[model samples]
Target chain A: MSGGKPLSRFHQPIEVPGRRLLHHIHLNFVKKKVVGGGGRSMNQEIPLIPFIDFLLCIVLFLLASFSASGELPIDKNVKLPNAMNAIEMMEAPIVAVTATQILVDGIPAGSTRAIIDSNTKQKIEELSEILKNKRELWKQLKPNEPFPGNVILQVDRKVPALVVKSVFQTAAFAGYPAVSFMVGRLAKE
Target chain B: MAGIDTGGGHGGKRSSNHEIPLIPFIDFLLCLVMFLLVTAVWSHMARIEADAKVPGPPREDEQDKIEPEKELHVHAKERKFQLVWKEGSTVVEESEVERVSVNVGDDVTFPELAKKIGKQWTDHGSHRAAADKKFDRAILHTDNNTEFGVVIAVLDAVYTPQREFLVGNKTEEVPAFHVTFAAK
Candidate 1:
């Protein structure tokens, strides 16, 4: 404020007679030599601490926000129920049950009405066939090892137990006996 | 890391040959930061594994195996949890069924249930003497009319320990029972 001129007020465009507006800017900014009289280039050295701090903050924020585990492709139609003691989910074959239909790996295996209306024995034969094929493929992939009968069930929170049970029975009959229910984590009070 | 390359090295040495552009460097960092920020979502999905074994015909060898002091059963109704178990019969066929009911939202009921089941395993004279520390597996049956949330709540109650104990430098909570669901 002491060395510089006061800011000019703009009412309308007025031509100045003797003084120029942009003449002082080049003199203030452009310089031929970086070294000062004391042989220390104070203006040339950029303080990198602030920049480092900013970079560190961004890195930490990205790290904290990043989910290390691979996420299961979430089906927008199926809203999972919340559970208190739920554990981290792993990659597996998924069986999603929406309000209207049943899906195997995102493919429509059968209708929810068909499973709920029909008797337990007639519950979705198509789902069992798909599951059996998946099990066979998994077995072939790992010949010496025993098959881990893990199946992930992503059912809508509003879906009834009847539909869930039908899916389970079909999966079990198809050789995937272990069923894991996918749920949202309920916060502790 | 972005830096302003000054042609002047240290100690006031002057050179005009070196000048690094910072605009493109900052542009790349901003792009990376924006990409990461946009993709970041706090996912809360977790899993609870259950063995949905289909009940088959009775095997001939099962008749000889004597039942432990008690066998656990959890009957999940629409709005209540009915826990039934047998006390004194050597074989499951002769055991008496003792039933207890707790409403869905009772906070202490699940802890109390865990305590009851844990005591049943510990108080039994023979079960304590066995080499394996694990208790007998329990069967969970949810009625067709019940919602899946209630069943999950029951599973959480069964799996999570009632109390956490500070042992040495770490805290530990022992599981009460290994549970399986009744087939559809």
Candidate 2:
């Protein structure tokens, strides 16, 4: 500890008479003169306090955001519709209807084109099978509690209403009646 | 130089005084900030509630029951939207209906459809009052080729409160409609 007075309680970089030693470590490309006080630096203090405050503000904003659920898995091909009146994301079985495919809980159940083309006036068999199993499992888990017939439908913007109707009917036919459309939230309410 | 200068003549070796590693702490904070920023965007996913009443097989005890509230439906077509008013869920036949023709390409026309919807609801408000019901519920009937963006736009428009009414000394904003995305 063979030193004079501490240059700063928050340490300041030590510099020479004409140049800063820390900065000169990189090869000086241009020969330029620097005006430096004896052993003191004329360099402005980096505004770290304000920078930290800004970061804190951003952190606070993100923390206080309406996403108690950290992140939802958004389908790659599906473009969600933007709505101002949508509520917070609800926890339920997601039936994602893309351009070509119909997915129940991220698992491919069937093709959208097939459902639209086939003239069968029936609920989607594959989707119904999976949902029925899920319903039974939920019932087994909580026998006393009644089934909360809620399912979320996340459909792509381009997909026609025909496919959406089919998916909706299939979900309801499987005993999940209370449906919620999963939409992307717009800027303001 | 990277580590903290602890046991030295820089300050007296007071047990309470310890040097905190600011560089590593700053590194951790940078990591946290990056993580929070990345995760924040996915939270934009929200939901619109709609009741899809697909009547199941009836039990022996329940037989004849008619729902009193009318299910007003807005049918979306390629170039026009048809508003169908029904007296009850049991009432299969459409009573009074109106149409608003709009080009599918023009997004502005969709909001106009919502305005028509609001006006229709206001006109029926008196009839609803006679029945002692606040019939703000509406159903959206969309067929094949109707864009989901257009559906959401119409639904959002309907969800917004259009009128503020003075009730007992306070101005209360009455919401336009609780929209149900009807699929049959």
Candidate 3:
């Protein structure tokens, strides 16, 4: 085996006294030499091109998917009343007011039955109790602040104007004065 | 050849040549995107719009100020109510409309008033009031002393379904033909 001198530049078998019985001892020696020399050759280095390609693909996929899944600009079921002087609020938190209930951040804030009952003008004490509870909750969330958040009220079109007014009054009594009504932009078509 | 021979024997022990596969990172971002897509909610806001006007007559140059739509003015005074229906420059109807009066200390529920109003409007042929030129609009104005509940009850009575009547003797129930708030 020693007389057969190494012919190829790619791989050469090695003979070590202690590891002669090892099945891949010769190939292991050649692999070590090829990988160790200067340590910067293309064959010896890790292939980062596929990894970079994979990363770029992942980045593009995430960007596309994130944009597609972002919060929706508008909902169609809410038929907002029109106002000649209403301005758009792009970043405000949403509060919905259907014909029968008030929803704060999609959770029911108060019942329409309660509001109507209070509007009967016989339940001022009950109305005051509800207002006080709302105030306490708001204070806990935002200590020393006058309001809970930028409230966007979405009242249904079919609700009476008086009912809407009473809701606003109740909200104001609850210490939320910076409330704004929500409205949709007219569709182009 | 001697350097290559010496280097080949020692290269296998280097840990710097190892690299981590990237399949796991791709999996993470995919999971994140899925989570965001599933949790997002999309809804819109609502607002109101109306016009306000003061009573006045238009001059010759302001002839176009006359809006074609009729305006009905109803005011609830002490123990009585007034209804003024206007169409253009002419007053189509003006009269003192009567309401059921309760004693000084009686608890009158809205449902009772609603029934009374419903019966009166039905008997007075309010269903056909829209077809007649005698009235354009019916305005209901109430005093501050008037209980808001009474107003809502009156409105509810006028708008709510009272009873169901069957058609063609089939015994199928349908809402009674009643007064609609749309008329006012």
Interface RMSD of each: 3.2, 4.1, 11.7
Ranking according to lDDT, highest score first: 2, 1, 3
- Model 3 ranges off by over 4 Å: A1-96, A102-131, A140-150, A187-189, B1-16, B38-184
What is the CAPRI rating of model 2's predicted complex?
acceptable
Best by lDDT: 2
RMSD of 3: 18.5
lDDT tens per residue, model 1, A1-189: 233334466544544444344444454433322323234455555655577568668967896778655456778898777776677887789999898888899888989876566635355788988999998999999999988888999988677777888888788878887789998776644
Clashing pairs in 3: A33-B8, A182-B45, A182-B46, B74-B141
Predicted model 2 interface RMSD: 4.1
The two-chain DockQ for each candidate, comma-separated, is 0.46, 0.46, 0.07
Give the TM-score of candidate 2 (chain A): 0.62
lDDT over C-alpha atoms for residue B148 of model 2: 69
Interface RMSD score of candidate 3:
11.7
Regarding TM-score, does 2 or 3 come out ahead? 2
Model 3, B11-105: lDDT tens digits are 56654333344556557756765665565444343332111122234556776554654544445466555545456668766666456543222
- In model 1, the runs with Cα more than 4 Å from the true position are A1-46, A49-71, A119-123, B1-17, B54-70, B77-80, B86-135, B162-174
Please say which candidate is ahead in DockQ: 1 or 3.
1
TM-score to true structure, per model? 0.66, 0.65, 0.36
Quote model 3's TM-score for chain B.
Answer: 0.33
